[model samples]
Target chain A: MSDMSLATPRAYRRPSTRRIQVLALLTALVAGLILLTLSCGRGCLAPGDVFAALTGAPGADASFVVSELRLPRAVLGLVAGLSFGLGGVAFQVMLRNPLASPDIIGISASAGAAAVFAIVILSVDGWLVSLIAVVAGLGVALLIWTLSARRGAAGARLILIGIGISAMLDSITSYVLLEAPAWDRAEALRWLTGSLNGAQLTQAIPVAGALLIFGGLLAFTARDLEALRLGDDTAQALGVRADGTRLRVTLAAVGLVAIATAATGPIAFVAFLSGPIAARLLPGAKGLLLGAALVGAFLVIAGDFVGQFLLPARLPVGVVTGAVGAPFLLYLIIRANKNGGTL
Target chain B: MMRAERPHRFAGFAILLGLLVLTVGLSLTVGARAVPWDEVWAGLLGQIDSIGAAAVAVRVPRTALAVLAGGALGLAGAVMQGISRNPLADPGILGVNAGAALFVVIGIAWFDISGAQNFLWLGIAGAGLTAVFVYLVGATGQGGATPLKLTLAGTATSVAVSAFIIAVVLPRNDIAGSVQSWQVGGVGGARFDTLLPAVPFAVVGLLLSLASARVLNALALGEELATGLGQSVALGRLMAAAGAVVLCGTATALCGPIGFVGLVVPHLCRMIAGVDYKLVLPLSTLAGASMLGLSDVLGRVVARPNELDVGIVTAFVGAPFFIWTVRNNRMRGL
Candidate 1:
């Protein structure tokens, strides 16, 4: 492990205002990247055409591709990515564990399980199924939180309980699938792995609305989240309502995760990787909420774009994300181990 | 001083023996059919006429498969924990399951291999190749096969292989169906004929692990200390890992990736038997067999006539147990 190098204390030194300027620049860059992702895809819609389509242009093909096909998918990706990024940051900060994410903690699986059950057993509409998924996801999160709370929710204990819950949910899902018809099984599998294909405007609207609501709530608690990084006692000492902040954060994370999962299925690893990527990119930042959201959006959009055009036969966005995220997870593990750090 | 440990050790041994008997009994009696205890006993003892021919065939084959698969998984778990020195380590963590699954998928997708026997070797080869790949990957990292490095490497390999499996097989619905079910893990499709080649591998692996139990105990103290104690740390690790690969590969190939028994059972055994591999290894085997057999029975009973796969049943039970163990500090340290 590398020795910690402490900076010498300087009394009352006023920092330059350049940090704000830099952040503003980075934000612009991220926005530009998002716009670029929207324009560059299989649809071959020019930037002007996409803008014209967005502004109610007269061209039919441009409007159809942009409005009917590309727009919904892009908007869903943006919202889902924001949800995952924000949720991941909140979870990691609240739990004080980098590996803490909706997917890893069984939230996504629970949502997927609920959605599958709804699809296969109850025969409900997709929206009602997604609502059930949100409830199921929250249920799993509450269970893990309650179970790990007794020991003060240490990172390891939380992870262990999460893993256990995940495994159980997975098994139950499998058991359900086994009893389901073959077509249902295939549908469930597709949903479980996650896909952005055929994401209609209806799904996109609710997901986007959820992201806006929850993302705003997360932004409101940004300062508390930053304080949380200094540990619970310190955050509490700093007049932050630690428990309340944790609860709200947990709820927000779950809400975001559930909505995203409902819309796009459980796209794996974006929620897990986004926070770390943001933290790494924006070193010395007090709050990672905005950064994580940007990174999450970047990852999802990039992943979707690659999935669409990278291979001869287009793969699902989830597959591409898994392929990318698996190596990143390994890197995190190795880095943690090398530093004698716990994940 | 060493003599003082004998009574506790003996008690562990007794418990292990009891578990072995119980597992055998449970495996025979519990299945799709409601075979009474007396009939099960008669069937085991060659008094098969007591039961109908159909009942005998179904119960005997299923029971034997359970015991064989369960026992193999248990032993494999012990070997993996021994080699990795991590309580969380399981056969699946080393990519053995994924590797086997990938090959089986490949066999189904490309070769159109259908029967259990035809794909058995493919599973084994896949498992072996994955183990070797994980080992090489872990070794290439800064520290050679340190617990975390090995785990990371194994996990990465598993993901990569699993991705490959999904990519290749998902487009084809038939192969996807076969691969998806197997990926969930099970002991249901196993037959004695399918278990034949794997049995020798399991036996040899188990024996090798048992023989190296004391060495493992020393190695567990830390590799540097083991080296200082005149043990060849590298050789000990190699033997233990090879033993793990064989047992895990064979078990996965035969039964298609039974997950948490290896993860949860060894920790339970360690808590009961107190960390001496001499005791932990054998106790883990018995405990693992019992756990899987009992889970298998529950799988049958839970759905009644429908029947759940044993792997899912084990996960449903094992995950909670693993959580409880971790919470209780029983699975502390590793």
Candidate 2:
């Protein structure tokens, strides 16, 4: 159906059986991690008890832990992870750089800064901050897009500009937190260091809705994403409407991660880490949307598990992901250098 | 064009020095309580007659500390950029401050250590190790540490170190409460006694960087070119990096990881001093000092009665400048 399909990179042309196999495996892994997350706390409910609790088995303890606490948390882990994974890969593919995740590109940080501002300065609480986060996330992403697009969407330039903005926002957020009444310090810190400890259905529901809506939109625009991957001039020649596709992708991607960040408080490096790991897993896999999203889900769930149960003390999911993801980031840089590829 | 610009290089440094002196005056005279010029002058001469005198007494040391830390950071950033040949290079950008912060936190939490003096040693060790680690990681593989790789590696290292710091600090409420100010990097608490010890280290690092200005100049032309032109590129880089680490470590110890001062100051210096390292190095020192002093003053004035950290102020001031640099300039790759 596409005239310029031949010009697309071999990896981007179509997903092979191997890619499907990888995605299947990642889905399976995400399921396993979710089960582990649901059952691994306190009394450590047996799998049967967890299943019973899920199916309305009338036990107060199991139901409270599973339905009220762990269920929303597990659901959020899945939804937020999926959003970051998909959004990250979208940006990476559209920008044609592995490093251009929402985390690195000022989107998540903007949400964080805004949320912090709402909390510390305005003295707001609860899910209202999340709404502000989404607006701020979109606003910051738009600003970054405009600023970086001055000459061209060169990957390095975009990344550099994103970093500068993130740094500025981070400082402002920190100042607000520092100036806030001492009692609010712990709360601000928890928010800054992304956690799912008090995960409620209220937070998880909106994030899940965002994932479903944006995820559907991305699937429909899949052809444009593949076309844009072939390069702007070639995609334009192929009747792809390159800028339109970019705008659509950016809008959907930003919406996906903005909600996820609002829900999870910018889980560090899951968005940055998932795409490359997904690409590694499938090798020749192109259009890594599903694989990356699943991998992201797995990372968050697993990282949460590790943070809560694996360490001597309970740490936040963001802490574990950051600790784990940064090393992988360094490895990618090294490998890219070794391959003589422009990072 | 190069020959005609020789005499003007000194003029750039001269202008920066004058600006720095003016900034010092502003820092003293402008704050929560605005002291008149005569009161500030009288206070400086130890005439303790009025409420303004006490205010000036507290601000003078802070202003001086800002000058010292800012000059050190700016010089450190200049040297780091020159050595790495990466326009984006800054002590904070390259994980040096994060490294220093991590070690300082560890020293405070684990060893029951306190004071700027102990932090200085720990900061130096941590910064030195981080510099080596980032360089090794970035320099490995085919290209031997391109600007992109170094920046990426530096960023990764900083993230990793910061995560570890959080992991350590989060559990201890007492540590968390006290460490917040240090984490953000401020000079508000500077006193005459606290500011005295860091001076020697900053001065030594400054002299070392200034003395090696020629090596930095040659190395700026690329490693192979520098080598061909009778410079030991590796040795020059090592010396420059050492100087940077020391200066940055001292500043971070004294002021807690104020970033972007180093990152932004060098570019301003380069613009004024042309491409000559001999001029850029000294001009950066003055520019850094003046910029930080002014930023500290701005921080105090903006919030009015409540002060902002110099680190926060510098980011607000420097980030736009950094973004503009990226947008407008075709940066030279190291």
Candidate 3:
């Protein structure tokens, strides 16, 4: 074991140094993206005015663009990305599989399905819809847990069942879209693909609150998550309440995912991509909670910025993430195969 | 050897007979215009068939299309699972459906191909290309095409293709109706022409699939063992995947990418009859046809004036059944 550890020089080093470096780099990237986002749209708000508008200056169009349009989106991206990144970390840690993400495990799809049902079918308010989404998200997570309980929710089985459930819900969502009128179908489809466009302060409020609550909960459990990296039995032997910790973290992760999915439709691959990016950047990180959250936020903000300004017409943030993330996913698969197919 | 498999084969034969009866009954009696049993019998017998040509034309083709498309999808799914040796595998997973939909979107946007028959070959070509691409990408390294590797490659490629489809098609309002209908997946627009073009393709694909089933069963054990047993594992996998692509592409060209039935029906069939592909494959075809036929009928009946797409109705049924199945037994690894 010592020899094996010695062979992988980077694995045994203190993680905080790498963590700080990654966090610093991500913060810089996000700062640059914010500047770019502010500068691109009509009239090119100067950095001084952008800051002033963000601080709520009165009677300024730059204020309207910064505060109403860009700020909400940027803030939402930060929160949602953090939620997705942290949620992905929690799932990957608990399930002991790198491939595990909220979307892959059916939680985001469930939340999206529930939210859609509430909006289109029940005609509920947005906040109420989010509430129902959280409930449904937890419902799905619980359902998967119960179904896989007898066999102890092996990583592959969890993913397979999640895929099945996700497919079923996606089909149902499609059915709902079909049943809706043409205009409603278009709107629903847009929402399903996830966009940060036209996010209001009200929507941002709940998302922010959920993020703070869930983020804090996840941070508190980070050490236990590191323990979980060892096998369940070994972790238990090391005085970890593996089952209780897993259950709490899983619920908290679902809460974060539901909040994020409610804020932005599943926003393709943010959850799946963030953890690996963090892992790559912070090579010896004990737990990827903070780094993953930062990376996720960066991906979302970057994707949103590109979609808003780079494209001829503003595309959904999800589209940009998907376009960017798909190639990365392919790379991950190839890398995994090259590394002997363990992932 | 074939004689020793007789009872299981006989059970499949019995299920097929039952499915046939159920399908006929579903077609004759259930629909928006609820015809009486006597009238249905007369219509079948060509005695009181003075009904409007619209009703006869609509009902007959719809029912026939459901059976044909459903059988094709189920057969395709079983074949895909067999070849991939992955229970989670489906034609959609391989990007065949996405590829067909993408080209169909392009065809509608670019060429104005209104009729389904004109687009059938395009769909087949698209699906075949995507399958080949996935195979090539998956088989790139020394590990060669493991089931999990294929699934991951296929999934990633499908997402990229689907994103491309949405990006291109969503902004074009003129083709929105066509694209939306295709996406929902239905037999609502099926005609005799659509059914006819797919027949030869489905037949050939089905035959190829059955011929490769025994080899698939051996391959399922593991690639090395199957190779040791004198099976050309790579060749068998390619043939099986080709069969699946042909079956799915042809069917999805006729119907839209109808969901759930392909992914679920095979497992249900396998549960009823043990996992002998010879029996499972044929029974899956029958079960798929019956399930889709019944779902289409239910769609017509449930919504009254407006019809639900058969794809939607299947989820209402299939999702619960799937959840129940997972709850009841231990699902194997992918």
Which candidate, 2 or 3, would have the higher TM-score against the true structure? 2
* Candidate 3 chain B lDDT trough over 10 residues, lowest sum: B325-334
Residue A333 C-alpha lDDT in model 1: 58
**Cα shift from native, residue A187, model 1 (Å):** 3.1
The numbered model that scores best in TM-score is 2
TM-score-based ranking: 2, 3, 1
TM-score of chain A of each: 0.86, 0.89, 0.90
Residue lDDT tens for model 2, A7-111? 776665555766777778888888988888788786588898888888987754588788888999999889999998998888887787887788887888888
- lDDT string, candidate 3, B1-334, tens digits: 1332567668767977698678856775677776666666666665656563245446777788888888878888898778766665567656677777777777877777766666777777888888777767766665666555566677677677766766766667666667777677788777776678678888888888778887888877888999999999888888877787778888778777665677677887787777778778888888889888989888888888888888778766776665555455443333
Which stretches of candidate 3 lie above 4 Å from their native place?
A: A1-15, A55-61, A337-343, B1-8, B37-56, B110-114, B135-150, B210-240, B267-279, B302-305, B315-334
Per-candidate TM-scores read 0.85, 0.92, 0.88
Q: State each candidate's clash count.
A: 0, 0, 0
Pick the winner on lDDT between candidates 1 and 3.
3
| Interface DockQ of candidate 3 | 0.41
lDDT of 3 by residue, A1-343 (tens): 8997787667346567766776888888877876777655755777888888877777666887788787777778878888888898788767766666787778888999887777778878767977999999999998888776665675455665676688777776776666666445545656777778777777877787888888888888888877877778888888989888887898789988898898788888899888878877776645478888888888888888777677876677887888877787677666554322322
How large is the i-RMS for each model, in angstroms? 3.3, 2.1, 3.4
